[model samples]
Target chain A: MNFDDTPEQARLRAEVRQFLAAHHDELAHGDGAYLEEPGHERVDELRRTQAVLFDAGYMGLTWPEEYGGGGGTNAQQAVINEELHRARVAGPVGHVGLGMCGPTILRHGSEDQKQRYIRRLLRADDMWCQLFSEPGGGSDLAALRTKATRHDDGWHVQGQKVWTTLAQHCRFGILLARTNPEAARHRGLTMFVIDMEAPGVTVRPLRQMNGHHSFNEVFLDDVVIADSERLGDVDDGWRVALTTLMNERMAVGGGGGELGVRSDVLVSHANRLLPRLSEERRVLAVEALGRVLVESLAARYSGYRLQTTLEKGEHPGPESSAGKLTAVRVAHATADLGLRLLGEDAVLARSRDGDWRWASAAASTPGIALAGGTDEILRNIVGERVLGLPPDRPRTPAAATATPIAESR
Target chain B: MDFDIDDEQRNFAQHARDFFSEQAGPEHARTLLAAPGEAAPGRRVLAELGFSSLTIPEDFGGVGAELLNMALVAEQAGRQLAGPSLTTAARVAVLLADDADRLAAFSEGRLSLAVLDGPPSGSRPSMDVVGATHFLALDGDDLVIGEGRVTLGEPIDATRGLGYVELTSSEVVAQDAQARWARARQVACVILAAEGLGAADRAVEIGLEYAKTRETFGRQIGAYQAVKHRLVDDWVAVNQLRSLVWWAAWAADHAPDQLPIAASAAKAYCAGTFETACETLIHVLGGIGFTWEHDAHLYWRRAKVDRLLLGDESEHLAAVATCTLHAADAAATGELQPI
Candidate 1:
């Protein structure tokens, strides 16, 4: 109920704001061109920025010091996020690593595994991507057909992971494979840290609808991963995946970008576009403005709630899905509105230069909705897990029995 | 920091549940709902169970409990659909909290009071005031109670049809209008929001169960994209409303100063969300849901009625605007102004 931060949190917020302000010029200048490019270059710049944050003891605020972190609390992390967002600083380009994989490893990885990866991941020396989704296995990921057989020094892994964000540049990845087919669909899976440069692995960047190479199709052949690289129990990869997925939901669903984006920027955009509109278009524009205003307010307050929950030592729950759902809807709506504002010019391409740039950005949103998790999948999760809805029916025997590789194509 | 309920509130909630279950079972609820006019038999049962005496001070032979305890019982009653007289009785107790003689009468089960304000539709016929032992009416700053004929509709579960009460203010007493309105609005908002919460929760359960068992297109309907998404959306809506309701209830019970904004927000959000959840449940359940036998209608009906009971969404929104902006105006102008 109390919206204001505690005195200590307030002081921390001031410190974060001060730090970002001091580094403002460097932060702003470094990412200028990459801001419009949805590719590994921007990600690399982001990683470099994260290194600066890590060196300054600001990267792992909520993680325990024993795990190569600052050993702060969740509230402190929220404070840092809010401040960084306010400063318009690009977050860690290795977000999949630092936000999801690192946290998952800290919690579920073996001590040796932790020691090997945690510090490097935190410092952005090693970038990571998730090798989970395949052409066949997506929302129904438990049905993955990827196999990993036990070998002398480790496991021989072979699988194709699609939708691997920044995989072409990633040095490491969290891979899920079928370790025991006899076990239940969920039970047979195993999690491992696979080296991207391993002999049998190939990462082919996939140009999405937006012409961005943010995702790739990663093909893994007879890649050897040491037993020490396995996270958690041998056949408990599902559990490890759950840890990563939970962190993913919290990180992505936390609606960080939505909160940090300046409302005035949008408002000014609307005002500039308002007078150029036809009467009918003007009405639509006004309605769009009102909707965005309400949505922005909701986003801010919801972020405050998340911050408060973290302050109270609670992880973001199903309720956090509300924030994500609202954000995507708002983003889609705003993007659509922007297209309307562009009117005849919206379809124009700034470049036949064959380079991915901001002019081609409008197409990225539908991918945003489909990526991380599709809106449909998120709704199911929110309903069933968060709202205690009934479970979906199990897939039929034939469908269930079909391997993901055979079914996907 | 404490989002979880404290030990005392938890215990109080548990006690309220136990008491209401024992006192307002299905049979009692059915009988109360079937009762006619102002002098229903359930009044004695309510009095015996200390429902009418909750707000009365200790000297008036009442338990003198917190407003939160009353809210808990109201919520449980809503969950069970335990007749409208309980809400009316609760409102009466709130109205008579500072009136010593009325509190004594209510405590001893010798007098009964029915709130003259009808449902939010504003279409109720003038109430018959003759039979009521006392009629409570809002007249500016005064609560005028006199012998009058009271005509009431049959109660159905936790809601009854409109009652027309004619009052003769033989004993007219003046109180602070704003204070009375504030107290009355708080009680109304809490009870109505509780009812909406109960209906929405039940609707989700019903829809979810139906989705699991019902088969369509060689798969359980729950697996279908449309059904799952709708159910999920409703679930999200219900949970959000639940959060707002709890926040409003807590504010009303503990921090009266914040009641105006909190209650309005709670009422506005709860009414809209609960109604949406009800409609979405029907769509998810499809044909069978529309049938009266499915129990979906029970919640749907309750949500529809409860939404307009305290005040509709628009009313509350206006109230919020008035409370927030008008108060800001007064403060800015350095003048004492009443909304």
Candidate 2:
């Protein structure tokens, strides 16, 4: 029941603080804005920073030692992450690469694949993005129409992937395409490591409503991928994809301070803004701020519960969905409170007097529910998986006839 | 580094759950409700479970377990709609730790003490004190245990009636009664919150179960997004409340400086969550949930009462706000407080 760190964890925390302090000037400042900002120079600097972190035994701390990780517990990794976040320093670059892609490779990839990819991914030599969502299949990801036909030497993939975050910056992507049209929706798909530079593959950035080029629409047309690049067996993409998606939820769900504005920033904003409002509005403002604070605490503590699960050497499952859902509510509440505090000034576009923070939050926070998984989809996961509720629809006839995915896993 | 209940605490909770299920379950609560003042059953089981002595020190003839350990039992008590017996005992034992004979008497069920919920200036309402002989109330800056005359009000939760009391004769329990009373209040908050958390957890489970089994329009109602998502939100709130209860319990046992803020947060959050959970339970249960026969109302009543007991949700939120402003970093870094 103790929350204090162990002696070993404390020592690691001190070391991490010292290391972060040493690289304070070189690190990305201001709470991970650089991770979303796409530029060759920014990415190059990020790559070098990641390499330095990997060298310092901070990156991939919880991965197995055989794969060049530090072979440390998640708690130790958590201490480093907390210190890094508190210091406003950048962690490993290419979050998709390190958090989702690298972990998928370690768990479901072949020995050769693990050997070739794990270290490079950790060091950010090859950045990664997920190409799971398509224009036809956002929440219904299993219904993706992406086709990957077999070839003599490799597989040729052709699909349009929407909401491909950081695709323009990524060198590779974990693509889920239908390798067998004859099979069930979930069964026919296959996961592959598609080279973003392959011929006929195009990455066009999507301008977000907040005017950030953080998302992309990747068009894959006759893109050739080597046979060895397949992440898992043919027609078993759903199982492999689950591994990556679970990690994505874990990252997004347990990802505190990474997703939303800090509560303190909002508190300060309230302190500054509340004095100008009417008595009625001020009371409403205080209530809104308090609600945000409460939800933020819920998100934070639930994240700790997730951390404790990882610390106990258990893979996070649907519990991560709850954290993700709570995190979204916190973000939404903060954004709503932000706008409420601004009064009529909230309608003004980009008022340089720090009013933009709230406006930007309002714009960007909605997209968070869309990312990782939609709020509705996540609730389904929490309801079905965590609470053992029945699925919304009966299994498809083909799925009913086929082996249950749970059994296959 | 472990921020979870250990196996011993878990076992204690299981034991509490088993005992409550066997003795003080909703059916028993209903029975007590039917017969107004039937001396709420299960005092022997409560004694056997050692709940009364849970927070009392060894010098005071008690197990001297952490407040968290007792909180686990409190959660179970809430789940079964067990009355406020343990809540009262927890506050009494903490406030009367210096009085060993009184602690033993309370533990052995020879003394029945109910905590008064009001200011020190005047008459206070002692909740769920149906057959209590004495009351622990604030007497102008001092915590006093006194033989009191009661005026029982029409309790919303008839299973545990509410009563107003006037101190007929009194004695200060401790030297530093005010400070000890503050600690007692914090302990009460955590235990009540834990109980609310348990009640919320059960209420959600009841909804989920009904959702899974009950069919509407050729499908399980839970299969629909509207019902299922609402149920999921209930589940999420229960989980969140569980985190707060654990954290507040931990703070009470290990971090006194952090206890006030943590306890207030737990109490505040637990009120809304528990109330929401009970309401969601009824809604998900559909028609059966609204009936007087249904156990959902018991939880609803408890949540309504618990919310305003130590302090209402808004008051606790205000306290949390003040604490956070005083130590702004505590709210930012949720767990990393400077001990």
Best by DockQ: 2
For candidate 1, the share of real interface contacts preserved is 0.15
Reference-based TM-score, model 2: 0.93
Backbone clashes, candidate 2:
0
After superposition, the stretches of candidate 2 with alpha carbons farther than 4 Å from their true spots are A31-48, A90-92, A255-258, A271-283, A394-409, B42-45, B119-121, B329-339
TM-score for all predictions?
0.73, 0.93
Tens digits of lDDT, candidate 1, B1-339: 233345786787677667655654334433433454332225676677786576567887787775556666666665555554455655666677678887788777788665666422221432223234666666556665666555555433333435566554446555665477557766667666765666676677777888887887776787776788887766755655555556566666566776776676667767767778878888887888787556566566667766776676666665654454445456447784322
Q: What value does the interface RMSD of model 2 take?
A: 1.7
Overall local distance difference test of candidate 2: 0.79
Report the number of clashing residue pairs per model: 14, 0
Classify candidate 2 by CAPRI docking class. medium
